[model samples]
Target: MTSLPEDSPPLIRDNDRDTAVGRLQEAYAEGHISHEELDERLHQVLTAKTRGGLQSALASLPEEDAGTTSTIAVAGGRIKRRGAWRVPRILKVESAYGTVRLDLSRAVIEHPVVDIELQLGTGGAKITVPRDAIVEFEDLQTGWKDTRYKTRRRPRSGGPRIRISGTMGFGRLKIRHARR
Candidate 1:
């Protein structure tokens, strides 16, 4: 079991709380728990200050429904995810001399946060999320040409979060929001 240090701060990240809430919601949606149970768990998750507390709040929940891993790899063609497609918890997109677009406005988001690993070469990748979605880009190592990116909103409550990290070489990575 992964446990936090005893002397460390009791505060947990918002992402953790959101994840716990998402689990409770999933349990309710799957009929694994009743409304009362979901309410109780939501309360506990919202008030959880430590990692142990958060874990306890989600202890009674079942594992998430596993599905096929969504991997989009194209060499000189356009790759796009739009409409009502299911958004995987972890997505991998690799493009070369092509364009990759991931639009999440009407997508089904099972997880509170989505992780993306993008490897681009001489191509471009565009991720279009809802206006309220939270996007965090990090560990972006670019070669030759630096990456050109922009985000308008910070990660906020009630909105799904997207964390993207990876490499781009002589390519472009654009993060834009869908018009409300």
Candidate 2:
């Protein structure tokens, strides 16, 4: 079989495509991409078919100086990630006595799927994704805890996916769809 373009964007759904376009616009506003480059990249983002494709469109632009890992640890407070934020490849969520929420409705996912490691104690966590997003819950070690997956039905293709693996203690874990 032939190989796909190295710079090709990952196949994303319409929602992800729209979010990627928004990020391209932000890069333009931040002077990371020129007018022509923005236009070109926007086109690519709109038509990207793989995660690499979208990433290649912005490969030439400056990126956020954030840390490599995405982590949220809560002992007694709430942690929420919303709006057009970058979705890390690997995420770690820990809660001891508070709640953690990861909203992927408007997130800019860098990969076709993300691995989330969760550890909870006397607290809860919730993840909200787009209606069409796919979610796979892995082996979870829970102690008197409740876990619920309320996300919409998984699509055959094009949508982002999340794989969750971890443990919980007297806490609740839920995966739900965004209220569009």
Lowest-sum lDDT 10-residue window in model 1: 147-156
Error of 2 at 52 (Å): 24
For model 1, how does the per-residue alpha-carbon lDDT over 26-114 read when each residue is reduced to its tens digit? 78988999999888888988887788988888885777655446788888888888999899988988887787888998888867678
What is the clash count for each candidate, in the order shown? 0, 13
Give the worst 10-residue stretch by lDDT in candidate 2: 60-69
Per-residue CA lDDT of candidate 2, range 26-98, in tens? 7887887789988888888877777778778868666643435678886778878999999897889887878
Residue 56, model 2: lDDT of 84
lDDT score at residue 60, model 2, on the 0-100 scale: 67
Cα TM-score per model: 0.73, 0.58
Candidate 1 ranges beyond 4 A from true positions: 1-11, 82-84, 106-111, 143-159
**Shift in Å, residue 119, candidate 2:** 1.1
Q: Considering every candidate listed, which one attains the maximal lDDT?
A: 1
